[model samples]
Target chain A: MTASTAGPFDTERTRSVRGASWTAFRAMLLRDFTILDKRLPQFVAGTVMQPLMLVFVLTNLFPRIGQAVGGGGGASRFSSLLMAGIVAQTIIFIGIFSVGTEMVRELGVTGEVEDRILAPTPIFVVAAEKIVSGGLQALFGAMVVFPIGAFVPSTPVYLEVRPIVLLTLTPLACVTAAALGLTMGARFSPGTASYLFGVVALPLSFLGAIFYTWPSLDAVPLLQYALLVNPLVYASEGFRAALVAGEPHLSLFVVYPAMIVSAVVFTVLGMRGLRERVLS
Target chain B: MFLVPRLQQTPGWLSRPDISILRPRMHSLPPANISRPGGTVTLASEGESAGNGATPHPGAADVISTTALKKVYPGGMVAVDELSLSVRRGEIFGLLGPNGAGKSTTVGMLTTRVIPTSGSAVVNGIDVVAEPARAKQVIGVVSQANTLDQGLNVWENLYFHGRYFGMSAQASRAATNDLLERFRLADKKTAEVEALSGGMARRLMVARALLHQPAVIFLDEPTVGLDPQSRIALWEVLGELQDEGQTVLVTTHRMEEADEHCDRLAIMDHGRIKAVDTPAGLKARLGGGASVTVRADGEIEKLASQLRRAVFTTEVQVVDGHVRISLPQAEGAMQLVLAAAQAGRFRLTDLAVSCDNLETVFVKLTGKDLRE
Candidate 1:
């Protein structure tokens, strides 16, 4: 047998691993978007349908009854409040429930979460990227709901459009929704997550200023403060301040900074939970 | 738990001299047939020095090596125990075992999904326990469960995996297209993976694993639930991968698959390896021999004892209704075996000797059938 010499194969092989780090991270992000994109229709349905139904059902029901039955001309203003609150509510609900449920199912049925955990980037990046994509979806859902809300009757209190407030609060609200979803999604097992969606999400929606304003509930101090703790409260209130400046609105000072701070807190919690879940 | 630290604490083979420090513990067996030939196959040279120690062919560096690798679930079940193995560059190695065996656990540890209770592995020369990200980057894993995004199309699945490996969008697209073309899946690229047959999904998983062109690939029962034709098609694909100089470690319970596809294999049971060798090397070491099966009336174990003592036979054992014995060759040996069985008061119904197979090797070593 003609046995040849050594090193050629080994040296040439080692030289082949010339790949870079950035290329890997980009690949992971692209993959996440591809998966999210496929669920686009369901996202649009939840975002547009839920808010539109709430606005139309509430707005039309008001005028059929006289001022005495519908709480006077302010019925129109209340519908406007309902419109803004519902838009915020849909974004928060869709982002948290949709993203969280998907995560739970992914962790359950297929162990698809293993794909991200095993990717080249740190596990934290994978968690953040998934939430970021969820936030983007939330933004699109909110945008779609606003135009549809215009068709509702009762001369709804029109939006005034404060650029500074809208620009700051909208993204913050989206991030907060996503991060909240991430924290719960990573922590809960899939079996009990539907219960969370029904009990937790619905309750959070009610307490977080989706159907009413904060000062209107001033008689119940505990409820007002308790609702204040819900991130959706700050989001809806902040949107109200931006979209209807002349109307009864929560002060921009409290709503704007609170929205930003809550987003940061949720992001931190999501990052930590995600890191633990992936690494463990 | 003890095995995990031992694997991780020990340096890699390149730095450590004691390659066999995590040597597999032997289970008690009936005393070896003292009348028959017995020799220890030198799996590795004993006194070889560290680092520059001559490895018969210090040729291609090992793509993956585990040192005292172990995994123990919280419920006190030890799935994998002190597994030490080395897969060289460009070789297709198989972990062959039965149901509930730790083949999947061992694969999980190597792939960095399930954290080991102890030990460590270096995959593609990166310390898996110490630097999992680096190790992950170099290895591609096809798990027993389907991880494809069912919502996305086949091309998207391939593209995403490529992107996750950090390839550019254009690069991923190119790789996805090439893989689709190679797997003959180009026509079905736009279809959802959920709509594909089991075989198609499996082939796509393989294509996905190959997108980044990982240096080491872990295939855990890649063709487990496929139909016969699909199983063979996967076999050809795996062979092609081996031919392309990629190192692959596959775990499977299918004896024929392992026999046909593996360059080397380890037969595992009860969380340990019973035997490891090239398919032919294992059989030849059993001796270039054939196994005789004689189904007879009366107590088969008694016949087995009698056949063992007979001068005509080399080794004998009772397996179900038959007295199985191995001989160097079949021609004259079978007649002698049958004559001995007749003298032993055994009424033989069916007697035949067939060439040795992987199934026979597993049974001979583990005292149980692979399907068990």
Candidate 2:
């Protein structure tokens, strides 16, 4: 009612468009969240399934079969390392694939995305909302994966849980993963989405040092540096440093700064891609 | 495919000029008669002159205007070609064209959906290409296809549309309630859009477009595929909008729709404007007058030539063994044609007389049926 105090349908009602852009942005987020709320079961299933399977097979089944993951009592240490890796992987996969696939459908001939684009905000704002929404979904995936990682393994995996590092670094990792997702989603079409999961996502997760620590990957020095090109590597290392103690992991200096830089780079590229797609 | 018989005659209401002033050449016809031919019915001049009683606000000029606006898709397909026109503040303008005629493309350019490849378009005084976001603030577009979010209910669809235009939640809710009632979707407020009937879904789409109370509304094929009753109901809603001084640009291929509802219309074909005028003005300019169809056998060319010489007949053409005669009055022409048939010793199988309408004008200008 306050927005309409001047009169209904009056063009001069909003003297400033900055406030209008913020309102539109919030509305876009609200719409996505409302749809997510209605489809909670699907969201939960999608977010939970991958991490559960990874933690169960590598951390639970392999250990029960007496396959030494790392060495004696290395199973527990490996389990703790895999916990962080699975969580990071869940966030990255969900963030990228969910948004990318959905964007493809929305931007197709159906033009369902037209409603969002029509908002009195820049096209980049719409793209940012998708990233933010994906980030939140990634964070939710992390939360769901943590419990499964904690209980699914036969070995009792101990975590340091540094409050400062855990709180700050986990969000950074989730955001970096979300930014990577945004970049991929913006660049790929729906028909190529399946290829993205099979070709791009699988390589990123496996090469991200999810199963082994970055320090351990120093054994294969060339592989360690090559894997850094994958944004998921920084996220996986950041999570390991935050959740596990006395483990061979990347330094806090490298993890934090790399995550931030990757987030910024991916966000800029994603926004550029979004503008091109929208205007074209 | 079911066409109402042309023999039913043109309704008197169809030609009752909506505006007070009628052009000198647009003389009112008798209840069932047609306009006298040979007078030049020029296309109404652009801008305010083309409007009925519609007036722009003092500070605001044309509601929508385009100058040489064109759209060229990738691979060299030109969807809209050098379109230039001006629509005043409160007139109901119709873009009449068949499928693939660039009506939708023109609407897309004006609505800021499809970026124009060349030229310029201004909506609500804001250049569409330069300030699309600002232009979007004052216009609402209902696309040809259903773009409603099927996951959301009817009320939610309207509410979100309003919110996108910067309306507060309370204002959006209020507007949603008002629109639902006006669109007769109040009872279906909580129903999923996909669950509604085709007509209800269309009404919801229109209601959603109007929730923000835009200055200019573009509706692309708003009543396509709807039943007759639903189409009429939608027309009444549009008529009411016109009465309340809302500027509307609607695209449809139905000649009767343009004839009955539009104050003025532009006929488009192959990405070009074939003609533009008031429905009756177009009918008068191109329709010639009334027409009589004579189904007869034996020397059709002779019958046609003989009929063309009659005092009332303007032209005659033989089409598929039937004589189609254009004349000022069908009543007198019918007798003359019948007497000619008897003199020629040709047996007349059937005869029908009808006044000129938009379909006739469309066929005359485009050399094809409106639906084609």
Docking class for model 2 is acceptable
lDDT of 1 by residue, A86-126 (tens): 77887788667877777777776677676667777666677
Off by over 4 Å in 1: A1-25, A28-41, A67-73, A247-261, A272-280, B1-59, B283-290, B293-311, B314-351, B363-372
Q: Show the lowest summed lDDT stretch of 10 residues, model 2 chain B.
A: B2-11
Predicted structure with the largest lDDT when compared to the true one: 2
Question: Could you give candidate 1's per-residue lDDT for residues B1-372 as a string of tens digits?
Answer: 011112211223213333223321111111231111211221421221122222221234456767678888888888877776666556688898777678888887777667888887877656677766666767788887788876568898888776767665676787788779888899999998888998988899888887776777889999888999999888888887766566789998788888788877777776776666677666655435787888888888888888888845657877777878878764577778777888987888888878768777777766754454
Candidate 2, residues B54-128: lDDT per residue as tens digits? 212211224677778888999999888888766655678899877888898899889877899999997765678
Task: Give stretches of model 2 more than 4 Å off.
Answer: A1-15, A71-73, B1-61, B294-309, B312-324, B328-351, B363-372
> Distance from true position, residue A131, model 2, in Å?
1.4
Writing each residue's lDDT as its tens digit, candidate 2 over A226-253 gives: 9888878777788888888778788889
Per-residue lDDT for B268 in model 2? 81
